[model samples]
Target: MNSSLSLEDFIASEKASLSEAMQMIDKNTHGIVFISDEKGVLIASLTDGDVRRYLLSGGAMNCRAIEAANNAPKSALSQKEAKKIFHKRDYVVIPIVDKKGRIVDIYTGDPKEQKLFRESLNVPVVINAGGKGSRLYPLTKVLPKPLIPVGDLPILELIMKSYLYNGCADFHIIVNYKKDLIKTYFRENEAHYNIRWYDENEPLGTGGGLSLLKKEIHETFFFANCDVLLDSNYAEILKFHKEHHNVITMVCAYKNFNIPYGVVEIGKDGVIQEMKEKPLISYLTNTGIYVVEPEVLDDIQDNISIGFPDIIEYERSKGRRTAVYPVRGNDWMDMGQFPELEKMRVRLSSE
Candidate 1:
């Protein structure tokens, strides 16, 4: 199909939320979303990279789309000139605006028209599926947590496929509690899986499993918990991790919560300084996904039970570079609990 987008599908209001802007970008089939004023005048442009940087800098996703947009965007004054600029700059898409700054049309180019060179990344994935899922209770009694079905497939399979889509197929799974069940399921499944099993003799915390991978993985790899699912683009996560030269990159989600009651701040003289009623609070929280460099594996002590966070802290103490990539809250789901698991099932079924 051709790649031209309708005005409504390509343009978003400047006051629109970040989610709305993302939707417009997705609908347009192009990477850029144009922000327009009430009169349909183009004010700014937003790209996926712009949004990523804004979120990384702690920008709230609930804020106006313009807050993360490029106010000074390149555009052509005429359609004839736009084609020239588009070809010269090799832009994916460029907006053509009139004298009044309104986007009259867009110059669209098919990526198929150009020569593209893409290479697959060879990165191993490590999943910490060892913990006894006490929270999942009765269900955990019969089957391992990784074997639990999300929809048609087990949660662990879904996690593997998520990485598989990004050219990462090699997997190292840490198994302890109900390890036999997990191994059995993978063995019997029709689909061939490339997996190396690491059996922990005893309970090892999240980061402890990496001790087994010290000799196996010699490149950048992905580490994740078996219970969480993130909808963000995995390729971009890897790109960001490598660009920053980080020893470890944690994937975090920005969550928003509204206060249930009014809050007041008072000065020392008992004078009310400010008051807010049910204000929205936003925070970046860990989503249990990571991009780790191979050298960091040396930091893990042998046969020690330590959580991933402790290892991150230890690396920081030694002046290691640790960064975070923030994703929208709705893009992340935790299937550890019954409530969340049900939520994920419903959401996936709809998709």
Candidate 2:
């Protein structure tokens, strides 16, 4: 849960500089505070995670702390009062400010206790775990792709966290090859989630298996692949979907793959029209994450192996708005290959 900490309660001296902020980060006791002047006008705050992101981004000892700070709680709410509101609103700490409106502190509020809005538990996330990880090769030969351990945890766990962090708790996992192993393992090490399993007796494509999910699914929810790692806040995506009233929202990322030599473009006369250096090309790639309404299940053919793209194209032909939310390059990962698996393990472990 995010803290509803306000700027007022959280403000420390930004002038204390990065050195002082690093010390506080090392202690992990008090969140680094920012004081505007050498005096005591709290302007900003910093947390250990903030330091971690900065550090991972090659931050140095002399780097400015103000640049890395989130500065999120921009609302005009008091510390104590904001805390109460956040609790009643089902959010953790919300930033607050002093009466002067300069950033000051954070408020610690718990939604579980206050039962804010009692958010209707309608969102259902579906993860496609039915693929045979042919790309991962020998490692995946013994274990299912979802069960592959990237670091301290399996890939599926990490994928689930991406959705869980977005306030999604209900999950429908489609299992096929080695289904027993998945079921047995989760049963032994139970996660605090409402997981309703959908078993595919025969191998089915992404769209085919999704059709068999329990009839309880109601509102729009997200669907993700087991082999992809997407670092995003689902709440943001959900809000975007609602504001746009989109029936299908696909998460896309800017990606570029390299080619070594210069390329030439020719015209009809076989004359070189353009010769350019190894120019960088950008692509908006499908990150294998999607936001869709439950009505989409109706398009899936029962007991068929239909890939998701077929359904997406079907929706496109129907004139439904299939929107794409483009994310930055570093936010998405494809761990289907050996090199990518190692890279992801390193990145996640470092964090």
Write down the lDDT of every candidate, Cα atoms only: 0.85, 0.70
Task: Supply the TM-score for candidate 2.
Answer: 0.66
lDDT of 1 by residue, 91-131 (tens): 76788888999998887865556533223566899999999
Please write out the lDDT profile of model 2 over residues 13-92, one tens digit for every residue: 66544545545433322334444535454455565446545644766435577877766433445756776676566443
Name model 2 segments beyond 4 Å from true.
1-122
Q: What lDDT score goes with residue 3 in model 2?
A: 40
Any residue pairs clashing in model 1, and if so which? none
Determine which window of 10 residues in candidate 2 has minimal summed lDDT. Answer: 1-10
Q: Estimate each model's TM-score.
A: 0.80, 0.66
Whole-structure CA lDDT of model 1: 0.85
